[model samples]
Target chain A: MKKVRTKQVIPLFMAGFAVVFGWVGVFKLGFWNPDQGPAPGFFPSIMAVVMFLTSILAFIQSFKEDGTVKYEKQELLVIASGAGIILSTFIIGLVGSCFLYIILWLKVFEKASWKDTLIILAVVAFIVIGVFGLWLGIQFPLGLMEYIL
Target chain B: MQNLQLLLHGFQTALTFQNVGAALIGAVLGLIVGAMPGIGSLAGVALLLPLTYKFNPTTAIIMLGALYYSNMYGGSFSAILLNIPGDSPAIMTALDGYPMASKKKRPGQALLTADLSSFIGGSIGICILTFTGPALANLGLKFGPSEMTALLLIAMTSISWLVGENPTKGVVITMFGIILASIGMDTLSGVPRYDFGNMYLLGGIPFTPYIIGAVGFSQVIKLIMERDQGKGGAATDMKLTIRGSMITKHDFRRLLPPALRSGFLGTFIGVLPGAGATTGSFMGYAVQKKMKSEEELGTGAIEGIASCEAANNAAAAGAFAPLLALGIPGSGTGAVLLGGLMMWGLNPGPLLFTNEPDFTWGLIASLFLSNILTLAIAVCVIPFLLKILSVPVKYMIPCITVVCVVGSYSSSYSMYGVLIMFLSGIAGYLLDKNDYPTAPMLLSFVLAPLLESNMRKAFIISGGSLDIFFTRPITCVLMVVFFGVVATPVVKSMMKNKTAGKASK
Candidate 1:
């Protein structure tokens, strides 16, 4: 079997999405209604068709391209940090996740001095707490700590 | 002229303590964010948007407007000093700006030319927008459902132009945006759409968070990937003061002509659908290449810096015309601003001029104020800005990430928005990695609902007949133009292929 190129991945993914969307649009959501001029499904159904055709075209076109950009090793840390931030929010909440992610990323990965890390941490804290919290008054999501408390 | 009086009144409103204060803050923040590499106007606006939720619609918009306007000035700083453009529009500025700064040994003068050129270009754009905005709104009022549908179709087609080379990828992304937009509910029938039965899908994806994730957070992922990639070393050794950055009379004379020409040209480009400052600056630089310059462009010429710098600022000002007049966004930042307008509880579109003259005009007046404010601040802070460029990418990565997290969460005060931000950030990185343009997706996402609404309304009016799009005069003209835009590429490609085929044979 021939190995698939990284470039073809997204187009193929979109093509598959279009197929499911087209099926749902036609069957579940009617394309046209008797009373309404165009049904809810009308635009989506048409768009799905266009999307599928274009995605397939893009997929085919990808074969002509030479080199593909590979993922960097450091990028895994960033992705992990993003996931960790989101996951941390479940336990520590929004503000805590900010503190945790910044600290770990700076200390563990960046290997920055504690003094530099704390200074950046303080500025970020001011923004999240002093500005976003006290000033703007946005109600942040409650973590498990809040629920437990 | 009535515009003069309205503008004067606008200044009166803008001169108020709060509005002036807002403009000042916006100018400062705009420059800071604009100077930062990787965080362009789109992300700047998106990251700052959540902070404005508590502001009055007028004040919030004034700040964001200043931020957007001044950002054009901020972009040239790094482009000239370092080789990296702070934003996409500044790519052209870098060509001559860095050369003039380094090779010519006039970093101060290069920075000055950019600031002055920005001032002149932005002023030209504002003046044109002043006369044209109300006039366009008046014209837009004459448009009914069919005409609006046609106009929106034109807007939708312009996004295809943004995707250079691969028409198929453009089409795929554009359709994908429209589909994503259709997920929440049908506006006409009040029926639920492709929500997949998720409770959060009932409200659809939140606009601000989606934008922040797509443009800003994605940069986080991108920066992480490229952390080791060298940033042409920061100019840390030099210290610059405003007085030190003065240009010679000869330099100013050389700068003025191209700046003036590009100002008008950029303004015209700005008003076009899906054409923003990037195109404006690119075009301005390209035009200067043909004309006589004091020195050849890309070789430390003042004219080269002036042309692109002036044009981008002019284009930034000009973009407000369509957004304020017809409620159409020409580019991603324009779309973000449109989203801001809606968030501030003001209706955008033709009626916006008639109904909310104060809000509309105040924003325009504030641009003039911001241009001056940004110029002064931009000059005084050149020394400080270099220091910012020196900030390690390692620190910036975590800082931007936190902002993305906080900004997304603040939009709706929910983890749902944050989830969308993360998911979209990953998707955005993937799309960007594959060389797919995200600007079209963002543009269509904002315009698709308006397009679908107007299109459906036209269908309803026409009793399901397609003739409505073709029958009305204004609509017919617009549809003709839309078809022309859509068909031109296809025709060109066919011609190219035919020529190739003949040669091959």
Candidate 2:
């Protein structure tokens, strides 16, 4: 119950932060010139205002709310790990990143055997290479492999 | 007689070797994609759309149309066997389907029932499209920006029921989507808004990448997180045995009423913007629940499958209604279809009916053939497809992941698209974690630009008076209907509560 309240309230606070940043991005930064009828920052400025008002309403509502749900740490681990994997993929490229994420998550995090992880990794990598790269002619970023090859 | 001539011409168009080959390929691929969890018909069609850039407009549309209808049938396979609905519309089916699978009383009976109902509903829907699409297109010719704006408003309001416990949150999300939609350069003024000096922002976010990120990548993350919880899919052990006689006499008798009812329901709902298969299937399921005598429902009833299957296929056909008449999509899949239509250099509206009668009628006729073909293919292959269930999830997830990535990259040959894919994926994950429905958010984003542009254009044209929205008779009538539709659920809930109070008294 307490967790749900916190979850609801935090987004509103974050949205408030969004408003401040968005406002600064537009008005404080001097991005809009006097001659500009509707500057590139104009719409975002409006959005920031709306976000700020909505966030305030959200904050008010959070206090009035009753607790109905619980948040779990496992869920957060999933979210963070998934995000981490995706970011790492961008840096190391598809194959290497996917391999690292799969091997570590399965073997270490999931407590699966090394042999099982290796088999899973090999199958995924080969098929992805075969279907996406070869058959479909899609250009997946090779990452560091690009320089090596 | 005129109908006969049109039908003949449609047959001529649909029966060509190229069309047949395209239909066959489309049905096979669509089935495979639809059987995978969370990869809806929309994604499947969108993934295949670029290939059509090389084909003739009619040929390309026919292929996509086939894929669309095939997904309707194929989606049911996963829903019944796995209790994991492959598409949003199949959710209702999973309720009864999972129980039926647990009982193992009938291996393929439920699936066959669903497929047959889809066939029946799809045929009816296609017939409606053939006869009514042209007429509606003719009517749309008279509409201007004001009327279009009113129509879109009606559509958006219908989503009020979908807003969950917090209508405000839904509205906020929707407003956010609309605002995001307005980020790109404006068509009328040639002025950019929120592009942030990036040239990529000029074209606005491409529909395909946003969709894949918001839907596809989000789903993958969700599955991985819930992997051990078996939130992935129900593990059904029984193999489906496909046979013509699997649909018993009782099944046929039980099926027709709900199939026809849901078919009409789906077609009508499909005509409305934002009211696609998800809404249509729910409505059909709700109607079936009401009609059932409490003894027949939630216990592997064939009628349950019939109603949902009927509505889903009908909705698939129904979504084409507004697209053919107004060039506006009623759902996410419809948006992709609209893109395909535009790619063909074919603008759908009243002008289309007169200028390209053959194209319109032929497309309608091809839909009819596609449904029949899907039924034939699914029935013959159901047993084999069900065998795929025995394959370990460990192997399947990676393959599906590859498909998802490929689908995203194939949308455009740009690395930036992949970047957008990951960003949207992250956003989707956050939204999912926060207990927000991604569909409404995605929907609002898609409809935002249309709503804003139309409202702006109408205001400019009307010299800033809101009267333009009311001046048009069709628009006024539509607005009333929209409010009524949005209010019905709330009203029904209130009425139920009142009845309970009276009973207590």
Candidate 3:
């Protein structure tokens, strides 16, 4: 119950940020001019205000919350590392950086055998490049070196 | 008779060598992808979108539609054998399906059960589609923008009922999705909303990346998170056969009624925007539970499998109704198809019927063939597909991740899309940790813009009169249905508690 209530805090804070973000965005960007039916910034600004209000409600509701919610910490590490892998892939090529991250994740964090990890990693990398890159023609950045070559 | 004539013409177009070839290719690929554990029909369709650019508009729509329908049929194979459903629609099947497999001396009996049920259900669904889709398309002929908006509202509100235990949380999540969708430039006006000084945000948050991120990437990431659990092997020593004796007359008697009834329910629910096979299958199973003999449920009953397969397959066909008629897509696959049609320079609406009857009819005709082909392929090749499931999860997760990354990037060749995929993965991880349902969030994200735009459009056209929703007959009917959907669950729960109290007293 406490965890469930606490979870409301995140969405509420995000919602508050949305409100501030919207207000600033609309003011900075301005609404549609004549010959335009609605401004691009118009909906975002409106959403920001709505999100902010809802977040406030969520936050208030969190304080008086009475339900049981379990907070599991194990998942947070995966979240951070997984996001890092994706962000890093854009900087490095699909094969190199993604391999480093997967190895680190599977062996170091999850504690699998090096043989098991390396074998799966190599096969997966090959398949990803072969199927998606070669067959489907998805331009997954092999990074600067490949691009320059 | 008139409808039959048009349908016959449709069959002529569909039966040609080129179109028949497309349906065959679509069925084979869709079944393969669907039978795979992690990848789903939605992903399969999305992955194939880039290829559709090469085909003519009608051929592309027909091919993609075939893939979508077959994936739904194919998902049940994994459910019966593995007990882990390939997709959400297959969840109910896994309940009794796996149990039946264990009980029978021949575990392959479970696999055969699923294949036969899929055949029965899919055929019935296609028959319904042939008879009813044109009539519904005709009804759509009368819908104006206001009515369209009302229909969209019904879709949006209906999410609360379909989502998890908390209706309020579902609504909040849906509202947030709407707000997220509203980011970037206003479609009606060129002004940027929450661009935050980035030119890239001008296109708004691309729905595809978010989908890949939230559902696809997150799922892969979680597999990484739980890599140690590893995968179990498919049951060996089970001789699976598709013989007549296995699916005897008694078995057909058990299966046919549920298959037909669920086909209708699935089609009806599927026609409603934002409702898809998941709800259709669940509702079908729930209804079957009530009508079933106490002796046969959750024991690998053929009826149980038929109910789910029929509704889900029908729902796949039914989802096209709103997309074809109102230019509104009810689910992710429908949304992707809508995008494909628009990319092909074909606008989907009532105007479509008048402007391009051949293309429209061709796509409908192709479905009839696709349904027949799915059964043919499954009966022939499902045993072979089962072999792929034995590959280790540790190995599979990395492959799934690669697919996720490539799938996300393929949506747009932008670096930002990859970033969105990553961020959505993390957010998906967090939501999973908190036990918050992702389906509501994903569904809301898909339908949010339609709901908002239609609402704004309706209000504007009515000169800000709220009565527009009540005053228009179609709108009024849709609104009533929306409220009814929201209230039905609550009423049922209350009645259940009252019954329990009476029994205790």
Q: Candidate 2, residue A129: CA error in Å?
A: 3.8
**Which interface RMSD values do the candidates have, in the order shown?**
2.1, 4.9, 3.8
Error of 3 at B413 (Å): 2.6
TM-score of 3: 0.71
Over B1-505, each residue of candidate 1 has an lDDT whose tens digit, in order, gives 9988999999998989999999999998888667655457887788789889999888999999999899899888867865446676876787788778756657778888999999999999999999887564344356677876786676676666556468788889888888888888778888788788888997888765676677667767877655564332333344555565678899899999999999998987677666578767876876686689878776889998999999999999988888888888878888998998988888898788779989888989999899889988887876665454456667778877887788778766788888887887888788888888776676577668877887888888888899998888988998998898778769999999999999999
Candidate 1 regions with alpha-carbon error over 4 angstroms: A1-5, A63-69, B1-136, B229-367, B378-386, B497-505
Model 1 C-alpha lDDT per residue in residues A1-149, reported as the tens digit of each score? 22336698899999999998888888888887766687778888899999999999999899898786677766666778889989988888889988988898889887889998999899899878876676556667669988887
Q: How close is every model to the real structure, measured as TM-score?
A: 0.72, 0.71, 0.71
Query: Cα deviation of B267 in candidate 3 (Å)?
Result: 4.6
With a 3 Å backbone cut-off (N, CA, C), the pairs that clash in candidate 3 are A1-A67, A1-A68, A1-A69, A4-A69, A32-A39, A40-B186, A40-B191, A41-B192, A41-B193
Q: Which candidate number has the best DockQ?
A: 1
| Tens digit per residue, CA lDDT, model 2, B1-505 | 6766887788888888988888878887777667655456866887799989999988888889889878888777766865446666776676566556545445377778888889888888877877777564344345567776776676566444445666655655655555566666766567765567798887677655666566656555555645564212433444456652277777689888989999988777667655567667766766786585323655777778888889989988977877877787877777898898888899887677667766777777788878878888888886775554444544444444444454555555555665666667667666656555555666666555665566666776666667877778877876777677667768999999999999999
Per-model DockQ against the true two-chain complex? 0.61, 0.25, 0.31
Clashing pairs in 1: none
Cα error, candidate 1, residue B108 (Å): 10
Off by over 4 Å in 2: A1-5, A14-55, A64-77, A88-92, A111-127, A147-149, B5-22, B32-65, B68-118, B187-190, B196-226, B229-233, B237-365, B379-435, B485-505
Instruction: Report chain B TM per candidate.
Output: 0.63, 0.68, 0.68
Which of the CAPRI classes, incorrect, acceptable, medium or high, describes model 1? medium
Q: How far off is residue B351 in model 2, in Å?
A: 11
Q: Order the candidates by DockQ, highest first — what do you get?
A: 1, 3, 2
